[model samples]
Target: MSEAMRKPETNGAPPVISVRGIDMVFLKKAPGVLDGLARRAGLPRPEPVGVHALDGVDLDVMKGEVVGLVGESGCGKSTLGRVIAGILDPTAGTFRFHGREMSEMSPQERYRAKVAVQMIFQDPFASLNPRKRVIDIIGEAPVVHGIVPKAEISDYVDEIMLKCGIDPAFKQRFPHQFSGGQRQRIGIARALAVKPQFLVCDESVAALDVSIQAQVINLFMDLRRDFDLTYLFISHDLGVVEHIADRVVIMYLGRVVETAPTAELYANPRHPYTQALLANMPRISTEKQAFGQIKGEIPSPLNPPSGCHFHPRCPFAFDRCVAERPRLITKAPGIAAACHLLEEAAR
Candidate 1:
């Protein structure tokens, strides 16, 4: 085992949530009989392929911590978010919340868990019902779960809206009546209505304009202070992730390549893939030399590269990296990376 695969010492703080060895696979739809027959006549085989969305991913999020999950599109970031939110069952592995296994819970317990961990989806407009009033949308969860009476639902909705920077009067309007930023605020209000301890924010601000994104980001921070909320903030935008995340996990080809403090990871990214990603970030001045850009397209999840999944695109890949899969191991305190270059550097 490489030094990078070794576990780092913990500071005695228990993680609020832990995801161990998660694997998700989606089988491709079967091809038609004609296509199968064509394959017999020198055409490509019609065998069903599997998309490995999350391959043995392990993650730990400490209590009250905001962890950013960043990766390119199709890298399985959103899939991981859904799994953590209990919206999608994993093909393998276990998810635990506060030391309790989530999969083993009863139906009532599962409902409680769902209420405890809420989701803020990317498109606020699509997430909210077009015909439903803001109050109905925001208060639905609390009312359904018996957290508040129907008579009190309006009051609870108003309070949450105010906290999320939306006016109480707007609660009477339909989702179509609100602006994009206002709509997102309504989404936040709805998530907050459940009084969730943890939130899965899957590209929550990606659909909004730059100005709106900042507003929503600030609102999330303020709510964290007021409500003590922990977040699994998934985004493709590194700038947004850096602004909010205490720790950041970089994923590539459905696996975590590196995990570290936001500042440390940005300053000294251990994995070559991470370095390539950071290098592509837009710089303010032309005087600054361009960092190394990542070359080549990402490998398809249906047919991912063998050994280290990133070997095909990694600039520093060696012969060993082509044949030996690297495991996420600690390189520094609270920092873990899965890369052959980091292992060599550590040695």
Candidate 2:
């Protein structure tokens, strides 16, 4: 298989973007006087807890590769995406762009890095400015960054809009005047205007209809082919991930539990979390795909279970699973999984 089709982890080339030991914690503030009033009025009171959004996540994105990031809601998929796009800085850990530490980069270097890595947000309605015309939204950035002269902005905007399947005629319309799919295309065009080499697509198609989703996905494939862009596609839909990704990264409770070439991971998932997620996804064939029941609710991240975060819900939990967290270790060529029982499973 071509290097682009294989697991990117096995590639000797240094990653275009590398993330190491990323940990993010959100402090849920204590209840204010409103909480006391609510309690007095027999209303439910909010509990304060430090929500751990991500936990020691390590990931790498090779140039010219699409890596799917999948996990349940609140599992930190979006957080990781934002961190990679420089939208949010990790509370702890290191992010490197082209072998240089992101946090240590000079202001000029940082601006260049941020422009090179752009994000496509999920909700088009909220992401696009309702009041501004589409032309301004997409054209202003490139002109401000000196990517194009003001006199040429019109042609440049039209070119980008056309590439993303948006009509150049609609450039004068506001975001609210466009349909959901058109709005999303506008968002894509805006990202493309920045001349980004990497894109962090955080559930970029989840809100669109199934048919629209397919069209957008195909558009992404076409764009990738044309520009050699790298994508970090984050989604909860395994089906979509299966179709769009060359490699898949499975995260749980802010930590990556498994990563492998798309087909291999789906066929032979080592981590129990990955197994359960795959089993839950609807399949067209009736070949009995149930791996095992993933019992128990996902424990609260505020005070997650000791040792492995997934241990409480894992079917094969043992003393070690409850005492020490397992690192994501290589299991085979082009495959890696975080599970203490990998050796036993191999045997």
Residue 342 deviation, candidate 2, in Å? 1.2
TM for candidate 2 is 0.89
Error of 2 at 333 (Å): 3.6
TM for every model, in the order presented, reads: 0.89, 0.89
Model 2: per-residue Cα lDDT at residue 100: 85
Tens digits of lDDT, candidate 2, 1-347: 35544434435667889999998878788568898799899988666577889999988888888999999977899999998998887889998887788769999998998899999999999999888999999999999999999999999999999999988998999999888998999999999998998999999999999899989998998898787789999999999999889889999888899999999999989899998998888878859776446777877667778888898888889999999988888977669998889855666
Give candidate 1's TM-score.
0.89
Q: Quick one: best TM-score, which candidate? A: 1
What's the C-alpha lDDT at position 341 in model 2? 92
Candidate with maximal lDDT: 2
lDDT for each of the candidates?
Answer: 0.87, 0.88
- Clash count (model 1, backbone only): 2
Candidate 1: clashing pairs of residues: 4-329, 5-329
